[model samples]
Target: MKLFVNSLSFLLNVSVVALVVGGATGLAIIRDHQERLPSIEPLLDYRPSVRSLVEDSEGSPLLSLGKERRDLVSLDEIPEHLINAFIAAEDKNFWDHEGYDALAITRAAVRNFGAGGVKSGASTITQQLVKNVVLTTERSIERKIQEALLAFEIEKHLSKDEILERYLNEIYLGRGAYGVSRAAEIYFGKSLSDLTLSENAFLAGLPKAPTRYGLDIEQGKGRQSYVLSRMSLENMISEEEYAHALAAPLLISEGDNDTEQDQASHFVRSALTEVESIVEDAGDALAEGYVVRITQDSDLQGALEKSLREALIAYEYRQSAWKGPYKEDLPPVDSWTATPVLMDGDSYFVSINGEPLPLSKDSVKFANRGEFTLAPGMRVLVEKVGDKAKIRQVPDVQGAAVAMDPKTGRVLAMTGSFTQDGQFFNRAMDAHRQPGSLLKPFIYAQALEDGWSPTSPILDTGVAIQSNGQNEVWRPRDHNFSKSGFVTLRSGLEYSRNSVTLRLAEAIGEEKIGNLFEGMGIHKKAEPGLSIALGSQESTLLDLVSAYAALANDGVPKRPVMVESVSSKDGTVVYEPEDFIDEREPFFDEVTLAQIRSMMAGVTEYGTAWRAFEGAGYTVHGKTGTTNQARDTWFIGFTQNLVVGAFVGFDAPEPLGRGESGGSTAAPIVRAFFDQIDETYRISDYQLPDGAKIIEIDPDTGIPFDGGFKEIIRED
Candidate 1:
């Protein structure tokens, strides 16, 4: 018996030694892995990514778009009822536990042991914070060990409130919402403070399995009931509150139910872009939370959108052509007779009882065109509009429009692109297309400042100019290559006489012309060439309108602006419109302004744009521009108060057909835009300056024939 006892003791000692060695190895490995974990220093000053809001001047929300739709909030901002509800649902002993709940873990372990699988995680909110912020949610013994150890470490550094705040802001609540603040908005369309007991319970129940809960609305409500029952059982909420929460209906937002998006996607995009250029640190605007105040007037914006859309659709209708009908026979029509009139795969017809009639292009009207190439088995969308079927396809043609308060330099409305993705490109300010004849007024104004009068005669005959002094010469001529031998300076601009403009550029030194173009910010350091006088220099629509705004503003150039101010989430003004003001001295003198205004008025009244604004009761002053090959057509019209312009053309810079002109295309768009807002917008008339007199001139000869004024035709 003594010998057997000795052998057993020896075996026990050997086993003890082996177990100690194995345990030491495991501890060393775990220590190494723990050391390799990410540092938690970033959480010390965490700033959740918040959606940057674009607001109108009156502090109304216009847009709130971002990558992660988060709205960071402080622990104090969250209500006590919400906090207690989360605690009951997630970890009932949250306030009393030191980084972890021992009793809860024991119970979860017993439950899992009985189920023979991993069923529950008794992770405290502190542990969840470490998991979300500093570590991944990897399901492994090692990861859980690491999470628990990190939880203890985090609790030592951050207070209870800090951990809760970070957890609330960093938790992913599904539906692209990253935190409680945005979750309230996404699920209920309410602010944090505005949430009811029922709303709070619904949000609190989403932390564990947001995606699963989001999939089944009833399942999500069941989770909310569980949270509510737990809250009531824990005495976190009264029975009455729980009853009301259970009774309240779940009102969730249809992801992307952001009303601001529906308000003005195009303008919001423009404002966001402008915000980027102005805001130095992107975090200051989005991550740190800011409200960007833009100069948008909703009424004007609607009008601009309506006018641009209708005009583009109309243009597309005129330009559309049926590539070919579907190869298969079309369905039977009610009244039409179609007895298979096709012979050589040229056409198809519906069967009818009457005569065998062939289908003609004009027999039935095409409601939509210029978008698709009709082919066999094509699924055509047909909508009956009175007696015609109207289909929808985005046309190949694109356009842009802009409206501004000329005096204040505030951009009221802007529609950048007409395509479905209107925000893809800011055609109003970014597209630097050739201004064409719209540039004539500035050149004429420069001439008048240089001792030239309205009657100063310039030869409008053809002129040949050298290109880089090479053998290739540029023969500047009219739109139709039609030339008038000689014309007055006034007539030169009023008619957009390209030949006359080239002659004036030659008369005025090329260096001064270069200065004039560059100084106005039209084109940068333009090459010394007369071609610039013919609108060869590419300028954004906004820059051209701003130049005309100078003419309307009696010389002071007020640069166009979109964002009026930027404020912090706390409503502290960080950026003001005054900071962006480019209040430069008038680029043109009063006399130059008067002469140019007079000439532009003539252009609108009796020139290329005469028919567009013919009977416009109020005074209208503007010019028309049509680029070579009709690639771009523009019309910039303005009163003393407002400046509006638009450009219509293919995005690929192709011809928009032969007959399309600025007066026929873009002028009417601006006219349509003004017509909608005519009741709201009162265009102020241009007044003569002190010591200025009305000078009468013969329309045909540019000679002062009489002192009698024939309409608004006084030129200095």
Candidate 2:
């Protein structure tokens, strides 16, 4: 009896010691928690990084640029099914969990211990929000405890809806996108509210493994199926709804449907350079919700891209000769393993599954020829086009087009190259190439300023001269290498006569002509030779187009503008581009400018660009230019309201082949672009100034005649 009593006393003492030690340890943990816990204010007011969106003049989104591509939406805007899908996939007991789920933690610990490594996570939705916003993702006992403590603090401060909203918006959803809203737009090209049941399920499965599933919808399907099953098991969705979601195929949106691949991609990319220059920090500016308003017309931009592709394709078809067949091994018919061959008359040839198929006329009619070509060994996308097989060529040859509002110098449409899929080179603004005969209008403008009327006769006969630093005698020839002796200045410009322009430039003096070009916005230093009259000086398409805008604007030169304004997140104006008329000065007298415009009008009426707008009732004044050896081709023109410039040539400056002049190559592209414009946007005619007089001039001589056609003569 004494031994038993002693044993009980010792057990009591041991229990007392155990309690004291345990209490001390627990107190230490509480102290550490109190010291390490972070303030929940920042987490509650979460501000996610977002991209800066570029909008057109009409307020339509053109493109977005930044590291994080996110579109923030309120919790109220999120669909119920989408929210439930996430809850079912991530944490089924999200509503009941305070911070961490004890049951889930125990299960995860057991499963991880069995697997011999950390794999599964027991983090609740609150804990996930904590980890994403305030805590790091490092896997450790300390980090997990800190996350749990922070989550509990967050839950105490924010409501359930607020926590869910923060978590949804802060989570990364892959493809450079963050948050559910961006994920919905990126993966399905729809808003969170617009997402179907199956799409919501697909998006719910992304947070866990975004890259692995978001890029490959097929791989994501399995995870989506698992999520749908969980929703059904939890009774969040009906069995019929679950079954429908499971049976519904994942309809991923096209890759090019995103804002980055939109019609204004090139324009957006070009505008980004200017955006960065104006903003304090581009990434931060975008993250803080800045908006860039640019001078782009979405409809006109789309039309420009389409017309450029079609025109290039037609050019390729014209140049291509049928080479029997593709004759290469290809994949299955529906598979993306087809190769495009040349188009012969009515047939478009392509090899599919090692068999050559001839596309019917109807099928090839509407194909994106710019994207696909008949270039030898070029792989293309073959699809059915209205009862015919269409072969689309991946474009290789580069081209540029720029259209501007002459009245305001606003860029209506601008494409640097045929393809902008991630390419950064903006040829329209940066590429410097010979203007070819596009410079003749400036020479003619200078001639009209020198008191020489368009009716004055100039020798179109060939003339040889010794260039300043050259040993050989330089002889200038017309584009057709044929001489038309003693043609008037009107005929000289109308025919784009090289010899007559050189003579006119010589009579006016080369230095004066160079000064005239600089006044019209050509900043390049003109060479001291007659070739300057033929556009030997290298200039950008932007500058050349802007120069023509001066002619179209009656005499005042307006600077070309792309970005119109920029605003901060709170609707505060950060930067607004103001039109400074101080820089715009009259380069020519009103009468001289009128005469120049009239002479340019004669070009489209009967000159090389006649074929461009032959049947189109709208009258346009323009000039077509072809460099020596046909290396570069250009057609720049303007109506009273708009000025457009187009260029087509190899980057390395090689011949575009025989007979491919600016009139034949570049003019057609401009024609196609203008044809797509709405009638309201097209200018009918150039309004004549008050002091201009109409006089009938003889075609053979500079004298006025009663029998000849009447021409406008400016008398200011």
Candidate 3:
């Protein structure tokens, strides 16, 4: 019995020693791993005495999209009142506690656990800060453990001020912001340095429940008064101060606190998407705060948006007036409006005008359903009456506008329609509708390239020719349905003689014309025959704008660029538009371009687009095309700075009444854009490069003539 007792005691002693050894070994391993772990760097690095631009050169943030975020502020930069208010409302013994107060934590644990739900967190300011910075904003036991561990480490490493600063900057104050300074700016439109005690308390109260406090809505309800009372009750503020702060009215400044993307929301969204695609191609994440500086003037966007809304309203009113009666015998009257997209030939700063309704979200959803039913004429309903209001049974239709840079193919401004209520279907980039005589420029360009001088005799008299592979003889005619006598190539183009264009196409060969268009980035196959000469090739607004921009640039096509540059939060250039070089070769020779320009010059001076030049003070040179049966109408042209294209027609084929020519229907909208261009945008001059040689030539031919023809420049 004595031996057994001794053996048992020895076994117990050995077990205790073994357990201690195991624990010691595990602790040493954990400590080593902790020491080896890397420390997280601060969100933003401060460069020594270097100027950091919070906004772009245009005095707007590189990305002021969505709801404006508040500025980032430190605890020291914040007023004492704000800090006191926050401590009084959130955790009263915040300064005295070492990560947590035993008494307070115990009481909170009892109260929360008794309810069988997490009513209150037994968290100190340090713990909250740890959770915000290290752990995610999730309420769970595992996350709480992480937060506790991090808080204990932070308490050991950081001083009270440093911890407080981190907490102030890391806390989310709602309204798409994550900092106190940003909260103040979003709420009051001022910096933390400018905040008063009332303002400070208002912002300080927001960290608990920002949305519930109505801070996002900027509704200064009695929530401020409630916070002030809490501060007084906690002895953090004097009675007099609390009363004074409560009496103070909310003073929010209406300063230069506007969005860089306010008017250009549609354009900015597209540009951002494009930039994101480029970044993804490079295997980078877009969520890493990419600063995109777009080539958009906020002022121009505002003007365009304003003008579009107003025009839509006017059109709606006119439609409302026409509701009285329907007269069948009355002569048909075509009512149409043009939406022009103008972009810089060099830079892709796009400006757009005119307004067309867009497809509704409900309609899109209805179309997506596999099976559905609706009342007769139900589709025509749902016209916008005002912001967020709609009028039923109105003929609401979808249309789009687009503009791009001629040099780099960068899209500048694109408003799919007046009511931007759905995803953008940029008519300029999509929608391949046949452009009538507007495509004649390409044929004339081909004629010049194929050794046909501008003075070459082209018969304008009608002739039948086989079209496509159908062996169908198609005879194309002019607008007047008549033939002109023998005319120079330039004169034939100016007059838009269909027979002459057909003869020119025949001279160049159909396959050659198609190849030339393809070189200009037009992908559609040009059908063989006379109609191809009269703009029978179905092309999109983007295709036409790009082709015209080539002419405006003296034959150097620049791809449009909306986003100029994108940088990281550290100001390192992540993606730059200037870095990617375009490989598409120039489509037109300088001499041919010069001749084409002269012929198009006649469009504004003597042909279809004459009214576009006279009425609106626009330096516009373009051609108008009204397709047969009025299915599509187009006015593609360019100013000295930007190339613009406008198209107006029905989505489905229908006669758009009588006299729906591009000039009469679409030119006025183009004119309206130029008339207001200077009021809303900075005026830029157009210039030819150093080697462009200006020479006089007969309007009928590309050949140089002494004391005859118009001034034409041959870029060398």
Candidate 4:
């Protein structure tokens, strides 16, 4: 076959010229000047599109944002074996060829003639570089000739190393990476020095068809084998090295940045939104190659995400329904094997791959809970936890959460929605849902500032008020339907009694409460009605958290900000948010803030949310708000230094279950989230300011009474 190909090489060359000159002249039209070709100056002064790096508060990479993720490296920076591998795989005669290889072109032409079509490409590294940078990726004869001529021109201007460097730095290598250096991070999660022979070969084989071979394990290994054999045949590697590489296991990195960003999609997107506003021009932040410093604590963000997902899934499992299988299709139940890991009789752990994937505890306990036991092949959603993997599910019920530092108003972490792929609408900031009972604290705070004390008695029985229509009367009752007739103002908020709150609002009138709500930025306009007392107004989760931030920060509300600063790739300060954290003025006076916080503390103590945090070992002052029929449930709580708001509901209003309220649905989520947060912020008892009095009134008779001998004569 070689002798016959050599004999026909001349005929093929002649046929190539005849076909090119006669049949495909339109592809390569004659030009008087070389101006038709792009200049090599741009290649000499190369600046590939670099991805924006998003780092956490500690300067650790949380995610990357860009169109083409690249980490630029010079030819000298790349390892010698990697260069050898690419040369051996793509073009071993790269050093000898001027631009296009005549022998390779002749062979490719002969094969195309026999096959009756353009079957292959014989572009050397230089020609490919030209096609990638200067010319369109058209496969016609004109584009081909233009590409070859342009490659020859580039060869005259640039050295072999320069051409190879540009090719290596600019080629797309799958996973949104556009260079060998970035491909190393994406495929191996390490620098080139740490890449093994098998891993290096795998990357070397990806340029031909990155999407096809990079993702297909079988095809990737086959391609890697071919590249390895070429390297061996080209004397790039010894026989022993080739055999070892062939036998060595292909250790693919589990922690790709895209997937890592996906794990924190809500946070990454939220951070990028602020980053865009800060940078100049700010149209395309990814292309600007900015280094963004975000306020997200990865540890806190991870905890909130897991707890939120678990709480949502647990809510799903409690209902007497199944929200279909993962990916909307069940696994065949015959392919993969998963085993439960019993760790020291406490934490529950699970695994996917024994060698690569790390095991995560408490992520696979769904099977251990109900009758749906973990069979060997049962399909379940699994989340990649850094180096480990865990079983999980995407609950149909969507929700959002925000964790803020009440002291600095720095947004520690926030999630827009349950991160199912293809879901981009952020619920954390944009979701305009009714605050429900979460507004009780602010309501009582306004009332406290308006001459009503926490001990002020309010009739809890049903009261009728005028509605919008003529002679239309609106009667509001307690949420539990069972009224206490008369209860302390504190008890009204503690029990989340709708009637008591309405009575208090009626006494204080809508003007004062409306002004207070408006000041909290709950809404632009406040309505004149008693329903607003029961939180019948829409507000964002972030606004609600900020309102609670006042209670935690001595009545001062700190503005929630995501980005700390942004810098250019050259380390220049592009932009930094001046209002990153300001707003030192207090919304409520100290007395009102202290009194209202004490009343809210009663909520988790023995009121509606008691069962959720009875033994949580954390003192959380919060209110539970459940919308009509449990469509939306909210629990916005705060500690001495931290404030967190949790929301759980379907995208469109759907009933959570038969008996799930904010206390049952949302407060437990808050507890789960707080449970995972580090114990840096400690919960403390609310201190009543001067001139504040707590008078316990009898629920039956609305009369202040003290214990006969224990509490009658209390001393300060």
In order, the Cα lDDT scores of the candidates are 0.69, 0.72, 0.56, 0.71
Instruction: Put down candidate 3 lDDT per residue, 1-716, tens digits, no spaces.
Output: 24422332233223221222343443443344334432323312211111112233254764443333435565678888888877876778888866655566456545645665444566778877664444333343334434444555566678788777776766655334446776777668777788888987877776555433422224334657777888899887888988888888886443333433223345654565455445421101122233567776555454444444443333333332222112233212112212221223322111112333443334333323334332222222233333222222223433445555555566555655555433334455557778788878887887776677666776657678876667667765564533335778767777677777787777788778777676665555555555655766788776777777787765655555676666654667655655445466557776776667766867777777786566444346678888887667677666556565667666775555565567765554555555665532223244434544566766554467888775545443
Output the better candidate (1/4) by TM-score.
Answer: 1
Best by lDDT: 2
Residue 612 error, candidate 1, Å: 2.1
Which is the leading candidate under TM-score?
2
Give model 2's clash tally: 5
The residue ranges of model 2 lying beyond 4 angstroms of the native Cα positions read 1-48, 67-264, 321-358, 361-380, 383-387, 469-471, 479-484
- TM-score of every model? 0.61, 0.62, 0.52, 0.60
Looking at candidate 2, the ten consecutive residues that score lowest on lDDT are 9-18
Error of 2 at 201 (Å): 43
Error of 1 at 137 (Å): 32
Q: Is candidate 1 or candidate 2 better by lDDT?
A: 2
lDDT of 4 at 291: 75
Q: In model 2, what lDDT does residue 687 have?
A: 62
Which whole-number lDDT from 0 to 100 does residue 423 have in model 4? Answer: 45
TM-score of 2: 0.62
